[model samples]
Target chain A: MSPLLEVNELQIAFGGVKAVNGLTFSADAGEIVSVIGPNGAGKTSAFNCITGFYKPVSGSITLDGKDITGKRPAVIAATGVTRTFQNLRLFPDLTVLDNVRGGMHLYGGQNFVDALFHTPRYRKSERFYTEEAHRWLDFVGYQGGRGIPVRNLAYGQQRQVEMARAMARKAKLVLLDEPGAGLNHSEKQDLLELCRKIRDLGAAVVLIEHDMGVVMEVSERVVVMNFGKEIADGTPDAVKKNPAVIEAYLGKADEPVKADEPAKAEGPDITEGDS
Target chain B: MSDNVDTTRAPRRIGKPASRISRLFESRQLGWAAFAIAVLFPFVLASNYAMSIGTTAVIFILLASGLNIVVGYCGLLDLGYIAFMAVGAYTSGIIAKAWELPILFTIPAVVIMCILAGLIIGGPTLRLRSDYLAIVTLGFGEIIRLTANNLAITGGPSGIYGIPGVDLFGLDLSGPVPFYYFCVAVVALMVLGSARLGKSRLGRAWRFVREDEDAAEAMGIHTYKVKLAAYIFGAIWGGIGGVLFAAHLSAISPQSFVFLQSALVLMAVVLGGMGNTRGVVVGAVVISLLPEFLRDMGNLRYVIFGVVLVAVMVLRPQGFWPSRAYEPEKLDEARKGKRDGGPRPGAPVTTAKGGTP
Candidate 1:
């Protein structure tokens, strides 16, 4: 099967600091893959480059075998890629239903003339959107009030709404950034199931997670990064046994070194996920 | 086999039925209520002065509703929105005077001018978000006014005069009674259009842009183009309001497009409820007619009006009738049931790991 997404030698930088350096990975159709590392592991930077939020300094990103490098975020999104932010960005003041409907904007059911003139196409599209919005909310397992502002919901529920919004985009690849943050233990479990269910819909799922347990349990494949580079890539079991991956997490290799061994610092070993 | 599938989907079903009151308000029922009230308005006061006051109030509603699209729905701080109205007023005034055409016939020209003006102003300023955009719009408003004052076509400071009244089906709609009804009909149509647009897809895009521009873009909404759409719509709305204003006075002058006029329209939008059509209409009516009620106060009228406005702003910053968000019923009940009811089916099962995959 063709890879749903591919990134080769992706490079992103903020001034002199390399956020993502020479990273490469691919998510095949129907796979749940994860990029795990310590804080600032350049996971999100890579995701941004893939989703067109940040133009990569060098490298190529392809979706469904089609090159999509350096496109606008919306253009890339239209090519079947949707993502959630590290921080929930729900429309706080809009109704919950309206929030989900926002994701369907690209569907273009009616034009201004249709709306202003109350044409049949406008009515049909409006009805379709209303019905589809409810279906998406249900698919996300959101059992909250549909008419109230999203701001009134709890954080966990709000996260679900954000997920529903992204799901409504009906993309082929979904990127979730730290979805587990702030979610209660039970809610985290729900998120895991949600990820699986999302994958069952045949879209490739790529996530950035700090929780090793989630990485091992949910992802079919795991890519471990250290200092802006991929240090390990394989099945979860293989990545777990990789020595470089262990050192990236434990901060010390198994070998004993002399006290005077040349002190060396890696490029971007920033570790500090939002605990 | 279908039975099991239906059963599983049944539990996941979500229903959204708006409350009876909301449905009634959103439908033609509210329009009928307003119509009844409008029909009775002249009866409440038979004087020509009262009729004219009512006419002004209706026109102000049109203006406020237009501004609300730019500032309230799209969250664009358009300080120069009145410039569109100025364009419309001047365009119609010039056309009606020079060509001896009815003011109503000048509408197409007014719309074209307002749209072009919207494009010119919205194109550059929309690139800057929030505060800087506000400053640019403030300058834009002044630019339109100064241009009107300097341009020979606009009759300079003296403006234009002898603009003919609206002619409909060979009937002279020149009298106060006919003119008042005519203004009411136009305002009504504009209000309906504004409300309908607010519920459309573009309106959702506007709200999305307002809430979060980056996320909106991620949803395939072109934030720049959407913002421009809001600007152009607002300009069209204001332009129509201007046509009415010109026809009502049968003349136009640069003095009418002053900053004070812009401020008053903005005040109406804010005071009504930025995004609520009902609140905006009420706000415009109150702001326009409140001074008339205080007319007996003579010189103290302006003082009282200013004080009341300030007090309202301080007390109710959201406006007299703030727009209440329409909450989805299923989501509300689901949340309520989560606390009191049993665990929801299809709810994610948690693993030992603290992170959700």
Candidate 2:
């Protein structure tokens, strides 16, 4: 099958600094691929470009063979890519159920008239939404006060609500940015198992994660990057031993061997080995 | 981590049935009762001036509630809200006078004008967020007023005159009692619709976009669309209120739709709890009637009004009545029926690495 998403020569600049430079990658269907990089390594820049939050200076983004470069964020979202942020972005003032129901907006079971008139169709759609919200909240293992404002919940619970909201979108590809950042050990473990479960449900999962243990343990494959350039693309073990990947993470030592530079994988095949 | 210590999550047991007086005070049924009293109030009183004041108060209530949707629920500070009100009043007035149609017949035209006005103001400014958006709306309000002052179709400063009231099948709705009742019905519908919308999905989206645009968008809610919808709905509300206003006064003037009116409408939204419908109702009534109630004070009335507003704002920044604390019995019975426990214990009590399991 063709890859679910493809990015080619994606380059974005901010004045003098290049946030994402000549980056190219693709993620296949049903894969749990992790993008690993050091701080300020253009991971989020790439995510923003793909999600249409930032325009790439040079690149093409294709989803299921359709070009969707520089589209509006909502339009891009309609193409079946959804994401969560590094910082939890739950609607704090609204009830937990409302926040999750927001994910199904594009489903359009009811229009403005149905909402205002409280028609039978409206009631049916509302019931469906509440039931679906309950199911997803349950799936995420979010055991918090569902009726109250989300801001009232603890940090980890807020994170779960965000996850539930993303799941509510019913998207084909879920981009989870730093899902394990502030989560406790057990919560991180829950997240790992959840990613695998997400993959089992037939959606491609693209995650940008910093925790080595969580990334190494959960990802089907991993891509390593440094200074906006892809350094390694392989299974976890293969990437763990790749010299360039090592140099990217730990600086290269003096007197390095003048051997052949492993040719950069041509086209978007570079994303094949990354889980 | 605190699953074992579940004292906070304990459910409460009900005692005896609530008293009728207390129940009336607590439920929205009280608002309907007040509306009924306002409607029938003119029949009990013989004075035309009293009925007129009541009619004006009702119109003000509609304006306040409309404003509450944008400023209160959506967290948009619209200093130009009166412009929508102006558009509605002018559109209806010009149509009613020119075509000799009853003011009620101009409603569709009013609605269209207000929606256009909302888009014109909201489209460019909503992207600014918070204080900046407020300043832009203020400018737009002035722009509308200046445009009205310069335009001839608005009949210069005097605006349109002798605008016809509701005329239906030989019955005269022109009498003060009939007019008062009509105004009451209109205000009631506006208030009820606003309150209902607040509890619906669109209202939730407004709240979501207001609190955090990025988060709402991340949830796949188009924040811009939600904000625009809020603007349009709010405009429709203000437009309808303007229709009632022109009918009540039987004339329109550019002076009537001023910045002060916008400020006053916003004040009512704030003085009442911003997002709470009942609070807005109370706020609108008090704000409109307080000046009349203080008529005996003469010049001192303005001073007392300022002091009272300051004190209220200082004491209750969230408004006189914030949303009531969650009362399980008062909530939708379906949601209340979902449990024996108040809420489930926090997700199987994940053990912290160092803390007790």
Candidate 3:
């Protein structure tokens, strides 16, 4: 069977800058793939393109073999693709339960009339949402007041709430952008274990993480990106030994490697004075 | 991590038993108490003038509650809300006068007209961002008023007159006291309905859209559709208020639906608390009745009314009673069935983790 999410040759630009140039990656069901990149390597831009926050200038994105390229964000989300923002986009003024229930909207199973009338069906749906929200929060190990506003929670608790909110979507593919950023060491450990649990749910998981320890330990495969293109794609051990990956993360060696140099040349020539 | 960057989380407890005073102030009880006071107002001052003022306040509450759905909940600032009132009043007035139907029977037609107007106005403008939407709605409000001002069927500047009040069981409800009761019952129902909507799934969607449009979309909420739903609901509420207005006065005029009227209704929503229906109710009564109550101060009462409003805003920028993020604990009910105090006693329960043991 094909991969669950297929993003091929995705390209996006902001004025003169090519944020995501010819990036290609795929994640299969029950697999956790980590996209590790330096600052401005276009991981978020690629996420935006795949999620339809930004339309790509080129390339196609497919989920379950159907093209979802250029679809609206809501349409893409409804198609079983859900994501968490890098900056923790929980509704600050809404209760923690409401934030998680936001993800459960698609499955809430009641329309406006049912809600307005408070029919038995609406009550049942609301109950389902409430139970499911608590379940996901439990799954994410969130420790905070469920009824209070998320803005009143600690940063770590807020992060877990965001995780619970994303998981409540029950999407086939989950994209987490820097989920471990600003998390405590214990929280990071919990997040790594949570990644495995998510993958075990038979969903494809792609995470953009700056934490190498979490990425290497949790991801089944690591796709290293630099200059908006994949520089290395392999098992964590193999990728850790890739010279180009090291050079991208750290500065380059005095001598240049010629074999992998061709792939970088194929990307958009936005690096003005690289030559 | 900064000293004062809104790190307002106070670690205490979830599902804290509310105090007696706070419990009494819960939204549901507050709504009932407000309506009860409204029902009892005529007993204190049984004058026709007071009754008329009371009736107008009820209608104004309907308008403010309706606008709350749009501006307060959905975060769409509409400056042309009064246009909906004009459409409702005109539709009801013309139908009741020409076809000679009872004014109460004209409700369905008024609702239909308001929906059409909502679509015509909200469809294109909602696609624009907040500022542009506000500007376009301002223009749309004018367009509707001007359309009424020009239409000969509406009697142009003078508007339709001799409109019959609601007649129920051969009772001419046009008398001040009877009409006041009618307006109260209708406004109460409308307000209750609006509050019910505010607690529903669509209502949550509106708050989500208001808080963050892009994030709301990422969570699978179609921002455009939800926004339109809010707009239409708002129009329906305003239109129904118009029907009440026309019936109350037994006449309709273009002058009644002016930009200032829209602003005052908006002020009520802003002053009371944008998303809270009970707050909107209080805001409406205060805005409409404050000037009347201050009539003893003569011409200076307007300035005092303006000063009081400004002072309230200055003191409470969130409005008189802003919407809070406090959600009631339905989770506890679910948890009681699943988890009980058998294993972990006095262990300082923190995380609301729920799953199979």
Among these predictions, the greatest TM-score belongs to 3
- Chain A only: TM-score per candidate: 0.91, 0.91, 0.91
Candidate 2, which segments miss by more than 4 Å at Cα?
A255-275, B1-28, B43-46, B324-357
Full-model lDDT, candidate 1: 0.82
What would the per-residue lDDT of candidate 2 be over residues B1-357, giving only the tens digit for each residue? Answer: 334323323132122124676445667668778787786787687488888888888888898888888987789999988988889988999999889888888999999889898898888888888999999999998888888888999988878888877665656687877888878887888888887787677777778777777766666678888888889999999999888888878888889889999998898889988988888888988899999999999999989999999999999998987653233211234344555443232334332210110
- Give the best candidate by DockQ: 3
DockQ of 3: 0.39
Instruction: Show model 1 residue runs off by greater than 4 Å.
Output: A254-275, B1-28, B327-357
Can you write out model 2's per-residue Cα lDDT over A68-138, one digit (the tens) per residue?
A: 89987888887888889888877776667777777767774777677767899877776667756655676
Provide TM-scores for the models: 0.88, 0.88, 0.90
> Over the stretch A1-275, how does candidate 1's per-residue lDDT look in tens digits?
66889899999989999998999999987789998887788998898888898999999999988899989889998888988999998889887878888888988679988888889999778766765676677677776666778887889889999999898888889999988878887888888898998887788899998766666778999998877889999998888778787677665654563322322233222232222
Cα shift from native, residue B183, model 2 (Å): 1.0
Give the Cα error of residue B70 in candidate 3, in Å.
0.8
> Candidate 1 on B216-335: residue-level lDDT in tens?
988888888999999999999999989988888888888988888888999999998888888898889889999999999999999999999999999999997676776334432433
At residue B279, candidate 1 shows an lDDT of 80
List the lowest-lDDT window of 10 residues for candidate 2 chain B.
B348-357
